[model samples]
Target: MAKTTSDLIVERLIDWGVDTIFGLPGDGVDGFFEALRTHQDKLRFVQVRHEEAAAFAAVGYAKYTGRIGVCVATSGPGGIHLLNGLYDAKCDLQPVLAITGHTFHDLIGMSYQQDVDLDKVFMDVAVFNERLMGPAHAENLVDMAIRAAYGRRGVAHITIPKDMQEWKVSDEQRSKANVPMHSADLAAPLAFRPATALLEQAAEIINKGSKVTVFVGRGALHAREEVEQLAELVGGPVVKALLGKGVLPDQSPYTTGGIGLLGTAPSVDAMNECDTLIMIGTSFPYMEFLPKPGQAKCVQIELDPTRVGLRHPVDVALTGDSKTILQALLPMLKKKDGKFLKKAQERMKDWNELLTDRGTRTDMPMKPQVVTHTLSRLLNDDAIVSADSGTIATWTARYVQMRGNMQFSLSGMLATMANGLPYSIGAAAAYPGRQVVCVVGDGGLSMLMAEIATLVKYNLNVTVIVVKNNVLGQIKWEQIVLEGNPEFGVELHPIDFAKVAEACGARGFTLERAEDAEAVLREALAHPGPSVVQAVVDPNEPPMPGKVTTDQALHFAKALLRGQKDASKIIKTLAEDQIREVV
Candidate 1:
């Protein structure tokens, strides 16, 4: 007897190790839903309110578990909604399979309700895109999509027509269509031998120079030890990008932290002062902050050839796996004396002291840096942290130091808001026993507040901390810096986030004082189920140790002078506070 195509698809998914799928059902996918109902015990389907949230949830699951996250949506509008979250998954390099339902094959170009070219729409965001042309091709297509997503570490899309849902095939034929496991291909020839030679030459230049620095990127993820060894070999300090956080231990003597708009002081200083700069595994976009090509010899090692010399001109460009390339250079590199290393270490010490002092301040209404530091100290060493975009992300990036066992997940490339709660839900679902914390700003939390229902439905024991400042704080700071005006559209009417949490059947608390933060956080962390702690912070407080150019400072000053005639003295005091904190 023949089996339905939906059953064959489910069988293939099982073979691919997908036991659960996060999605919402519609008329177009009703037949597929029925297939799921038959295999209810073997394959669980999580129903979500919106397709976007479903996709976001899959990202969290993929990051935590290192598996291909699967989500389903109906054709057209539902599929369109999945694009934003799928893009987030794609950029973060998470493996996701987005399966959507389509109209009958004969209805092509007929303008049926919800008819759209899903494969074309999702092409840019997904690594692989295809519609299952017929029942015979379903098994092979599903298998290929899964492999592409897994191997490439990106999103993949598969569109299933409604007519193909109930089509049948023999049981033996279905069993033969099982997805095959792919082995990691480590034997491929390294791409950049000539580039590697240039890197060696760059190393010689570094040894000859007084100040050398390494700016690490996401490309160096697997080669942390090699990169650290390289830094030590040449007496250079390592500065990471936001996506490259925690690649090496934060406390490593050679590590100088990240450099960007939301960067630390020592990192910015190291990059600026270096005589030779080595770019590893990063296609960093901010060319203005990079060392001028002539001032510092810039050498870049990347996997993609197009990325080489695309941003800042590279004096040397090596295209290969960071591990393979760095390993090759290790034998050729000579041990350098410690003068440069010592200077970099001293700068790092000063930076660490500055961060410690600012975090210990008692006068501020709620020092965000202090709160993040305290949370890092209080949480379990193995805990997972998911931070939303905006000021909260900036604070977390600077303050949340990750230990070996701890995992930090964020929407890095997409930089999307409202990712924290759903990400936490997905992470908790992926690792039910591990402690998961969702760090969100007031504005981001308000956008997808309904996902709190998902947490409640799953009874996920994730702790959510909302930084409540009654404004879109990051953009407000930008307005203060650039436009020299008090922010107009950034202010938000206050919402009782704790009460909302309670309404969603999760425990909730409101923290008004900084002193109460630690205890409240500890309590929430200890809760048996999902909880929300709304931390009301000062709106006017400035982010610590922020970098401002001379021109930016002038703009800020002009804005302050134009707006507050009598408050010029107060503005000057605030600006002085930022400067003092740096030293």
Candidate 2:
């Protein structure tokens, strides 16, 4: 039998080290499914309840493994449903390939069922977007698409016509399985080197400033050792963007976790106090948290030249691999004599004491901090956590202590809801036998409750800890800051999520009080199969910002003028002994 495009693509994927795929089968993709069936022994296809879940799984797979993730969907609606998850990949800068099916080329313009303008739909989201218009160069096209995604560190998309799925390739092309280089293996030795003059320019700026604060982001994930060395050489404390949290272990002497709304007070202080800001491999938005233009001498190091000075105008912009750029600039730097890093260290010590005290409180309507801290204690050294957006993320950011070898991921730039469950599913699927935990709020969990069944079907060991605040807690806080709009629609009617999990054929549990938290979570953690532990947390506890400017203080006064009753609860939570000393 002659080789089909599906067979050809699958063979190439095999060579690229893709042993699994996530998607649901549809009529438009019958041929591809048939090809997958033939390759079942080599590549396992994990069927998801929704197409979006498949995309989320792909993104999670890439995030966990540092490799290109592949997901497929049928034409039209099936393809459209993938955009949210694909967008998550794009925003987080994960490399993923999305293959969407189309109707027979003959039927493309005739409005056949499920016929979408797949090219147009995916163009904006993908770095490389194309439709497979012919069979002659189909294999090369697959190679190009996958390479583009992995090289550009963004999404790559391809549209396939149903009729060509079984088309025969040339004898030479169909000879035998010859997989191309795996994306990960190829990327390891690849790096761009900056010019010598730029390194000297950056070093000069760095050496002149006495108080330097280093900012790192996702791009520095693979350069942990180099980043730490750079921090030591510059006599600066390191602050991470939210997605960059685990880049430097919290135990590192100069590390101050994350900075901004979900960040620690020490990190906030570092940004405000530093005279020189050395941003390495990060394009963190939230300019309000940074020193004003000209307030600090800035040096930005990024591989992509276009993004070198994007966040703030820099005195020196060095473009190259983060590890490479820092390596060149390391020897030229002299350690500063200032005490900025020490002062920030002191602040971090105080902040740590404050969070630990708050996280262990036995207050009724258990604080969410307690839930996160407890979970952190229970996590195995190799555990992977998939946190969702909103107040729960803030708790995870501050309260969860990540010490070593553990990975933490969340929807960073997109900040979308309902990604926790799907991301956990993906992480578990990719790394069998490893514990994957999803920390999400009630608002996020309820949005994609159906995917719980996917967990049971695969028997993936994922523990989902739903922090039940029974309100859109983050949005409610935002409303309060936006001049007390009387909280029009932030309330969430509490659902017994454990019961929902039990219905889906998974173990269900609850933690309503602080006393039961450890025991209940331990039980869930030990469960052999998927489980949901719904812990009721205090909704009124404020998700405190690291710093509150005078304008924000004035806005809070306006919020009080509009008579926000919920504000009283937040204040009461803040005044509790656990927070009083810190706030």
TM-scores of the models, in the given order? 0.90, 0.94
Local accuracy of candidate 1 as per-residue lDDT tens digits, 144-219: 8888887677899998888778776543243344443332212224345445557678667666667788888777
Residue 322 in model 2: lDDT = 86
Any runs in candidate 2 off by more than 4 Å, and if so which? Answer: 170-189, 565-567, 577-583
Instruction: Estimate every model's Cα lDDT from 0 to 1.
Output: 0.79, 0.85
Clashing pairs in 2: 15-179
What is candidate 2's lDDT per residue for 1-583, written digit by digit as tens? 7887889788878877888789988877888888999999998899888899899889999998888888999999999999999999998888999988999989998988887988899988999999887555566777888888887888999888998787776533432354443223233445777788878888888898888999999878888988888887888899999888878887688798899899988898888888899998887888988888888999998877778778887988887788877777898888776488788788888888887888899999898989998899999988899999999999998877776788888998899988899889889988988988999999999988989999999999999999998999889878876454556589998899999999999999989899888999999999998999999988788887876656665666577568777666765776774444322
Please name the candidate that would achieve the greatest lDDT relative to the true structure.
2
Best-fitting candidate, scored by TM-score? 2
